[model samples]
Target: MKTTGSPAGTGETAGSEANGAGGAPLRLWGGRFAGGPAEALAKLSVSVHFDWRLAPYDLLASKAHARVLYRAELLDDAELAAMLGALDDVGADVAAGRFTATIEDEDVHTALERALVERLGTLGGKLRAGRSRNDQVATDLRLYLRAAVRQVAAVLTELSEALVDVAEEHVATPAPGMTHLQHAQPISFGHQILAHVHAFARDVDRLRDWDRRAAVCALGAGALAGSSLPLDPEGVAAELGFDRAFANSIDAVSDRDFAAEFLFAAAMIGVHLSRLGEEIVLWTSREFGWVELDDAFATGSSIMPQKKNPDVGELARGKSGRLIGALTGLLATLKGLPLAYDRDLQEDKEPVFDAVDTLLVVLPAVTGTVATMKVRTERVAAAAPDGFSLATDVAEYLVRRGVPFRSAHEAVGALVAWCVEHDADLGEVSDAQLAAINPAFTPDVRDVLSVAGALDARSAPGGTAPARVREQIANLRPTLAADHKWAVG
Candidate 1:
């Protein structure tokens, strides 16, 4: 490569700069100008490094657009066939790493056009007639993100199933449920794990809902004005598997709402994983002593011979901030842009790609973590009854035995105060102490004070009682199956 530019810092013009003997910059846009873009602008304008990930999607759109060109008589039958063949070859080479974008190529669209031109000569140049990189890139991203959304959704399914399996295996396992970081009640351990599963189910649902909005094709919205050629945008949309063609050309090219929505969904998935990770970290801690990580999932510290760190859980927690930053960064990039596309729109792909990449890697590791971790049931059961967690059951039991709810609540509060003052467990109060607390605190209150009694007392639908937990799983499996089917679609 050769170039003559206003020197790097001299502020001279490089309008006539050439990067090759032919004096062209190996770009798609130089024909309109005498020389090339300034080296500074050229270097800054290049997006192939990140946008190259869109190469396969770009080529797919190009193939669809070529058919549109042929139908419009812009290209003859033989030309369309040649164009499709060239695109297929380029796709294969790209997949195999034999063909790749160069920095001078500017972006995926340009680099791909360069490939086509090299393969088919002037026949390739004919392919660009009724489209612009604005529409092409927009369409490519929709295609790419739609697929990425499904990929993320599928992995979410994996994590969700991992959680469901754990839930089923431990439906009878008792654990302390907390509010404000303090023990609130005893709940089925399965119930706690299934709660995470439900959050991930919503993530999959969010992606599916987003896909409906993102399924429109943007190809014929060339450069933000509808193409003037006899274009069958709807036909092209059908060919490309889009739900429909763009109704508004400007909106089509400039709308990054889909990308933002996806990052939001990805960020939310990160948040759910962070919460699950947070709990995993807590459970595996010596202070909690409720869970132990599988050897493969736990990490050893360099200096501490006894360290078994929850590195995977910690990474899941930390990466949530990264995912959220991707969403916010795109919103900032998009906030001031007017109708139609701008170079700032070029910033969209990296965040979208990174979020997709991040989740695909994170979900599998977290799934493995959930699937393999060991719960210390004895410790969990012991902790279940600590901190006066059974107090709520005592209050409910009083309510059932003809005590006014508020009076029963007061009676239970005094009993708890007595227990706290005397350093006694809720179940340790004898009938003499019950009479001392209140007459409503009958001898039978001791029955509900048991951990299993506290768990089974709330046996209505959606309760943590073992039977209800099993029923919940029975209902949840079909929903997960439906979710998996929709996600893979």
Candidate 2:
């Protein structure tokens, strides 16, 4: 494998300076080997393609390590300055898409190390002292994921705020709430939207909690044991914005619980998004007609001239399976691994990257769907009281009239059964029919049978009443604002 030097450099390639006797690019580890690795084995072992996304993080870790080397008296001030300059060049090249990993570069660390050596000669070589690819990759991954967590959180906050805005617009619009796919009661459309907002609020909390555990640095845990040099792990951790260094050297490089936790949070987000997507799909359908998807967020069919499909919602619903699969597959990868780093651990990044990337694309589309969609207030309100949705209100009415709740429930159940047999609506059920079931009935029972009455009756702290929903929205604004500040900051 040959090192490809960038045109900006002095044309002195890493291979020209550090190639093995056989002319293969110098491997960071291969002194003990009799010959270069087989072509198939090298190809199979390389991760530079996917892991190259970690280049910026790898550069940060390298800079930190360089400082540690300088502090330990391993590198002089000039060498440290030169190495830092070369690392900056490499980062710039990477950021500008000029630097890329080759097949010879086994992973991100190797690629960046090769680039640094190409730029600054031996000064670049000194950057790897007292550091192993094991801990280096671990540190890089942690840094990458920490930033990713914040990015995802920020987007999630956006989605939550989108939901809040929509909820505010529809605070008094009636919609049917469901249980087992049956109309359970009437609730404000605002309240239904807030249910999703509340779920995302919990997701934001989970991300914050996960960040605390993820902030432990892995840079000093060199190859599953503490580094021999006088390296300041605490300083490196602090420099990289970590809370602390890992307690155990072996645990530091091996710990992937943070990754799993992120995936879990992501998966839970997928689940919540899928629920919203499912509802969007349902609501946009002609059968339900509760909402209309915006043209920008929806698509038209190829053959059907009149088709307007909620493809964004459909994809969100479909992609949740992919998120769950990524989580399960990652868990499987981590299940039987022994202590410390292994090549198998290389499998971790792509799955999580895929999950996070999937969410990155899915979230904004779903947010736009929610933000731009037109809620059909008349249709939702019309459907709000259908399918015996007022039966619970009827039962509650009897309960308020001094009847036992169980008896009230039984009376309402029988009345509902009667209505079902006669194909009659709850509002159409006469006072005679109500009194036949229970003496608790009066003409006043009809007051509770209306959808608006049903919505206002339940005014407890988390109920679907308009006033309570408004209070919930007001209370959630501060929390969302605080979390958004933290996420963006």
Evaluated with lDDT, which candidate comes out highest? Answer: 2
TM-score of model 1 relative to the true fold? 0.94
User: What digit string (tens of lDDT, one per residue) describes model 2 on residues 1-489?
Assistant: 333344224444455545556677758898798888899999999988899889999999889989999999999877788778788878888888787878787888877877887776655678888889889888988899989888899899999999999999998999989989888899999999999999999999999999999999988889998888999999999999999988999999888888888899999999999999999999999999889988899899899999999998899989999989888988999999999788888988998899889999999999999999999999999999888998999888788778899998898888889889999998887888778866777778888878888888889999999999999999999999999999888
* Candidate 1 lDDT: 0.86
Identify the leading candidate in terms of TM-score: 2
Query: Cα lDDT of all candidates, in order?
Result: 0.86, 0.87
TM-score of each: 0.94, 0.96
Global CA lDDT computed for model 2: 0.87
Tell me the deviation in Å of residue 135 in model 2.
0.3
Give candidate 1's root-mean-square deviation (CA, Å). Answer: 5.7
- Give per-residue lDDT, candidate 1, residue 217: 93
- Cα lDDT tens digits, model 1, 204-320, are 889889999999998899998887899988998998899999999999999999999999999999999999999999999999999999998989989999999999999999999
Q: How large is the C-alpha RMSD of every model relative to the true structure?
A: 5.7, 2.1
Model 1 ranges with Cα > 4 A deviation: 1-21
